[model samples]
Target: MSPAITETMIYDALRKVIDPELRHDIVELGFIQEIDIVDDYVHLEIQLTTPNCPYAENIVAQIKRAVEGVDGVHRVEVERACMKGS
Candidate 1:
């Protein structure tokens, strides 16, 4: 069986990714909608408070960097989604 992805690892990695506007980690801000690991790749669905948020690209880049730092991660794929309300 494949090893499970621990919540602690996920949270720790995500904590390194900050939301520029909120001045807090994306995990703390609750912007990470979901995380999925398949093989060695990590897929992330990230939700921003607004569709037109100025820091969207920066946030995505930071998230990719953070996730890629994990020991078993070979690639990081991040998809952006807009939150229901800003």
Candidate 2:
């Protein structure tokens, strides 16, 4: 049996996803807004610098790939997090 997927593992996987313009891992930039394990799927919320950030699609893709590559992650869902009070 595979080890259960924990939030730490998810965070570790996300470290591999880098922001091209910032040249930093998305985790370090605090882009991971939320993480929830519902049954076999992992739901993730990513906070972007802005609602209209041009790299939204690409960054999301990268995050998907990174999180899904983790051993016990059966699925991944990504969405943008709204800015505080906005």
Best candidate according to TM-score: 2
**Cα misplacement distance, residue 23 of candidate 2 (Å):** 0.9
lDDT of 1 by residue, 1-86 (tens): 44556556777999988777788888888888888887778888888888889988888888888887777777889998766754
Clashing pairs in 2: none
lDDT for predicted candidate 2 compared with the true structure: 0.88
Tell me the tens digit of each residue's lDDT in model 2 across 1-86.
66888899899999998888888999999999899986668999889878888888999999889888888777899989898878
Q: How much does candidate 2 score in TM-score?
A: 0.92
The model with the greatest lDDT is 2
Model 2: ten consecutive residues of lowest lDDT: 37-46
Stretches of candidate 2 off by over 4 Å are: none
* TM-score of each model, in listed order: 0.85, 0.92
For candidate 1, the lDDT comes to 0.81
